[model samples]
Target: MAETVKKATRESFGEALCELAEQNKDIVVFDADLAAATKTSIFQKANPDRFFDCGIAEGNMMGVAAGMAAAGKIPVAASFAMFATGRAFEQIRNSIAYPKLNVKIAGSHAGISTGEDGATHQCIEDIAIMRAIPNMVVLNPADHWEMKAATKAAIEYNGPVYIRLGRLAIDSFNDPETYSFELGKGITLHEGNDVTVIASGLVVNEALKAVKVLEAEGISARLINIHTIKPIDRDIVIKAAQETGRIITVEEHNVVGGLADAVCEVVTAECPVKVTRIGVQDEFGYSGPAWELLDAFKLTQPHIAQVIRDVVNEK
Candidate 1:
């Protein structure tokens, strides 16, 4: 395991994809005309023959990737998160998810990080869209370590997988010496009785930071980093809800149909608890820096802490 921490999820994905391509000859890459921007250029430089630049046609690229996967090649397709999930959804559903093709849809510049590109490019509905599709594996890693491990796991897992990558870099959370990745399993960063914060992607790092702030104020906060959004770690969430009377779900996506919604669906049916969601409200994002966008949507650390405090105080 590497000890270095990353600043952005897309960079983490780029580094991990290059490493995977070196180890697996069948691991091929396809970029929809944004290799340099998406950082897949590293893999393209290392394995020229195994890399394909499919221009800006994400839909066509998806169909081609499905074809390649059907031919026994492990195709990892890259594109803007918006186009990958928004424009190419039908192909992803019928061609990839339906047949359960061995394709890894590694989308970069997800969420509000495609800053300045505005709402037209930001993928706020990606998680909800991807997770709703049957037979598709959805992953939203918290940091660099989880990204690398999840990348490897997605490559080995036998099915169509959608791994969301953010443009904003996040600090490494797990201790390299001990932490190991597990698919569909949740990791509890802190054990608390007052509240539990279930988060994914860069927001997980933020929630962990908020937990420290909460601890200083005498609030014991439990942090659950949900790396897999599709096969969500419902057991861990239900257990947390059972123990912690209040729960706060956080993410870099819309509050509806994403991690928060998923957790609520599980907890409300299995073990009802006080739940508050911290994320982009149901709306499109505008052009701005990533942090500004997060702040605008109330997905910041302080906002999460405030939500936790409010939810805990309620009833």
Candidate 2:
């Protein structure tokens, strides 16, 4: 048998959407003229009658999705992260979140990996914006398996959902044949007592690598993958704090409202653990390679491991 190649987040969105459409006839897909880029075109190709093109108007597309949800249809509105989160934010909050509609907003080309397109196309603040909306379930899947599982989970889940996907090829984490992902659940990747690294999305891949680096340095680093941002796993974070004593958070998003902030909110209020957040520190990114941008923002594996060391030493 040939070895199976894992798909990227973009590929996961394509596969998941098509699979869900096969099971549910009332599932409709709407794209803001970026179907190809957002990977919603996969659904469009499979079910042309059920897919809609809302042109470049993301706000109107969001409203259309909310209306579809009201009529008992599951509508997935797809667009770029910046446009979906920044441009259609009002519609998402008012039309979708306000009513707690069963609509999934899949934002693609997120973070600096959208790259070369420059700062205007990137969305470092998406997590912050979506987290602020009441009744919104924010999810940033770390790999192909998680992304597909999240899309399936979103269908059964009611209310508004924001599922962020990346444009670049993402790393694989979970087993595609067996791993099951649940919303608001955190998966512990590695166990250790020296320090804990809590991360979500693309940064989780780097954190996993950091764990190997720490092992070579005679440090046992705990790795926790926080896939769901909203309704974050409190128990996992608290347990990490109690076990590791020191905690550091990593995310491709800004430190403000992303995984870092979400973990900090839990640890500070309950455990009061020594926590350090490794992410973009309230600054915009410049045009560069995805890895370069991560390095520039101090979100690389070395930076995360160093932060883990610092946080552990602080205690």
Candidate 3:
């Protein structure tokens, strides 16, 4: 097998923003003094006139993006997940979501994968907060290709969108040439009848790895990638629950309000099944290496596989 290309989703977001800006001049980008880290600097370099640096004020950046969106420009506000969704949440709720502006909020370095930046920087609750807002569309792309596609889709979409981006470099699983991105839809990567693993963001790759391990042990695991968390693909989730007696949700975020919550809502409403959520428990992350953090939090492939195995074995 050929080696898979690895790239951070933030890098994909920046490159996609630059590419989309070339096609649509209405696209504008705003950063809160962390463009380099968020990779929005790529857009700043390519479109200097359209890029605005809002110092260290993430809230102010969100307000500016809302104002720009009000004026018919597609404004993308980029910042760390903790600051973008945590600090500027009120601005995003009142200024952007209230009026239903076409502002695209990109939160990079999301989840515990933010590594040594530690608990202060790691954001595990952005998904829950963003999804709670009335007019917000939550998107959490899994791989480099998915991020690029989702970025373009968010630009074309005329509403408030919250896109979660990651800092960890992950293997590219989707083929850019063959991949087609649709909003509010889930992609089934593997087919199985026994159990279903619904996952998003960085954990999608881990879910894929766990599938191989389960298959070797005579378990058939279906893998679903939910790129859009809000307006989740309810039909696919309901179908998975109906066909597969057991369901496991894997995410790089907190188990409270991320992918697990979304899947549970669907399963509880439609076809009830035994749903197991694999993610960070309700707690802040600590300072550690990215891979180490994943293991410590039990987000690794073996951990994920074991959870699925237990669910399958449960009578």
lDDT of 3 by residue, 101-189 (tens): 99999999999999999999999999999999999999999998999999999999999999999999999888876788999999999
- Per-prediction TM-score, please? 0.97, 0.96, 0.98
TM-score-wise, the better of 1 and 3 is 3
lDDT of 2 by residue, 163-272 (tens): 99998886686777777788999999888889888889988888998898888888899999988999999999999898878888888888888888888889889898
Leading candidate by TM-score: 3
Model 1 lDDT tens row, 1-315: 456586677777888888988778999999999998788888888889999999989999999999999999999999888889998999999999999999999878888767788998888899999999999999998888888889999999999999998887767877767887888999999889988889998788889888899899988899999999989988898899888867888888899999989998998899998778888888889999878888888888898888887877777
TM-score, ranked from best to worst: 3, 1, 2
Error of 3 at 186 (Å): 0.2
lDDT of each: 0.88, 0.88, 0.94
Worst 10 residues of 2 by lDDT: 1-10
List runs of model 3 lying over 4 Å from the truth. 1-3
Candidate 2, residue 135: lDDT: 97
Q: List the residue pairs that clash in candidate 2.
A: none
Error (Å) of candidate 1 at residue 172 is: 2.0
What C-alpha RMSD separates each model from the true structure?
Answer: 1.4, 1.6, 1.1
